[model samples]
Target: MGLLKFIAVGAAIGYGINYITKKGPNGRSILDDITEDAPEWFNKAKTYATEKVEEVVQQARPNSGY
Candidate 1:
């Protein structure tokens, strides 16, 4: 019973992946859209983290020198 359930779930997931990867009326696959935007999000996160680390260093510098 457990094995059958697992196979059914796996098939459903595989079907979903196949469906999304097909181009819609817009002429672009769902995977293409997601991958296109990934880099922008990654760069934004990197910038935000750098700014935060700089702030922390600036705050600690004054205390240490005193």
Candidate 2:
């Protein structure tokens, strides 16, 4: 029973992967879309993180007479 369950789970995962990678009528798979857009998404996230870090650093610093 345990072996059968494992096989069934494996098969389900394989099918899901196939379904995602299969091209649609527009000729692009889910993976293709992700590959195309991932760079823009990553850059946006990185910029947001950098701004937050700078804000925190500024708040942490003590006032200087300068």
lDDT of each: 0.94, 0.93
Clashes of each: 0, 0
- Candidate 2 to truth, TM: 0.76
Candidate 2 per-residue lDDT over residues 1-65, each given as its tens digit: 99999999999999999998999999999989999999999999999999999888878875852
On TM-score, the leading prediction is 2
Quote the RMSD, in angstroms, for model 1: 2.7
User: For this target, which candidate reaches the highest lDDT against the unseen true structure?
Assistant: 1
Structural similarity to truth (TM-score) of each candidate: 0.68, 0.76
Local accuracy of candidate 1 as per-residue lDDT tens digits, 1-66: 999999999999999999889998989999999899999999999999999998888888966763
Q: Which stretches of candidate 2 lie over 4 Å from their true place?
A: 1-5, 62-66
Clashing pairs in 2: none
Location of the lowest summed lDDT over 10 successive residues in candidate 2: 57-66
